[model samples]
Target: MNITVFCSAYSLDDRYSVPAAEFARLLGSGGHTLVWGGSNAGLMGLLADEVKAAGGRLVGVLVELLAHKGYQGADELVMTADLAARKAELLARADAVVVLAGGLGTLDEVTEVVELRKHGLHDKPIVLLDTEGFYAGLRTQLERMEAEGFLPRPLAELVSFAGTPAEVFELLAAAS
Candidate 1:
């Protein structure tokens, strides 16, 4: 599967970085491709490096502004005009989307994908890798939205949560 991973471009926490590499390793070993922001920093870089070392295909989508920052040696690099275009391209090429521990940018990407799915733009599986409870608040908020009838359907129908990389793969296998 072409798994689009939304994660932080920068993080000081090993808690996030360690699992990011493990997830990449698993993806590579499983023969899955990785699609992510093209940057040689933080979890994004770590994941891409691990995937490449493990012999997996890496596809990076970055905007012109971000492209100058440097890439983590993606086998295929796609440059976009801006962030919106980058997001569009990422979504267009993904068979599935994975949300990892990240900050504001990651949140934006994940939320946009979820909203797109909600609006029937696509039916791709979206998995949240809640490493170290990073996404607990977001999960709770999603549930609250469903309980209040703000969502057209239950969030669970659109998103799956996995505490570990192994569980993420399990969910992906079942989804496939």
Candidate 2:
């Protein structure tokens, strides 16, 4: 299945490089497509590199603006004219989304999916790969949404949390 993973160009330890690369390899080996930001720096770079090394298809969606800001481009990428076009392409191509540990950038992505489902734009599954309690706070916020009237309990059920790379990928496989 074509699975898009939303992540950032950096990792906190900044040690997220290896894990991102490893996750890409694992997904590739499991016959899943690797989709991410088109950059060859930090986690973004490692993810694409790992996918290429594993002989898996790596598709990158990047805005012409941030293409070089991150240092490089994806192994298999098609440049977009602007951020809007890039995002549209990324969302259109993926069957499912797996959000790994990321900073504000990743948070924006996950929230976009939530908003999409909330507005009835789409009903795609969103899997949060919360390694090391990365998404604990976001999870809490979502739970609060369900508690209040801001988000319906049924709509809030759209997102799933997976604590490990193995668990997240397994969920992806099951979606097929």
Candidate 3:
């Protein structure tokens, strides 16, 4: 599977980095490819390094601005004119999406994907890796949206929650 991972580009928290690397190892050893932001920093770098070391393919979609930062670890790098185009390319090739602990950028990516799914644009499964309960607040917000009838469908129908990397692989396998 080609799994697109949305995660932080600069978070020093081991609570997030450790699990993200483990998940990458799992994905790599399982013969899955990683599709993500092409940054060799923070969780993005950790995951990319693990995947490469484990012999899994890495595909990176980067905007022109960020690509200039250097140290991008992707077998194939796809450069886009802007962030929107970068995201579109990322989603276009992904079989599934796994959102790890991240900040505003990650939130933006996940929300856009969810909106696409809600509008029936795609049926790809989106998994939230709630490492250390990091996504608790977001989960609550999603629930509130569902309760308020703002969501087109139940939250469960749109996203899957996995607390561990093993569970993430299982969800991805099941999604495929």
For 1-176, candidate 2 gives per-residue lDDT tens digits of 77788887774454455556667888878776777777776677777777767777778887788766442434467789976677668778888888877777777777887788777787667888777777888888878877787785463357888877788777766765
Worst 10 residues of 2 by lDDT: 67-76
Question: Candidate 3 overall Cα lDDT vs. reference?
Answer: 0.89
- Highest lDDT among the candidates is held by which one? 1
User: How many steric clashes between backbone atoms does each model show?
Assistant: 0, 0, 0
lDDT of 1 at 138: 93
Q: Cα miss at 152, model 1 (Å)?
A: 0.8
Tens digits of per-residue lDDT, candidate 3, 1-176, equal: 89999998895677878889899999899898899998888888888999999989999888889877534557888889998998999999999999999899999999999999999999999999999998999999999999999998989879989999999988878877
Worst 10 residues of 3 by lDDT: 66-75
With a 3 Å backbone cut-off (N, CA, C), the pairs that clash in candidate 1 are none
How do the predictions measure up, each by TM-score? 0.97, 0.88, 0.96
RMSD of each: 0.9, 2.2, 1.1
RMSD of 1: 0.9
56 Cα displacement, candidate 2 (Å): 1.0
- Candidate 2, after superposition: displacement of residue 54 in Å? 1.8
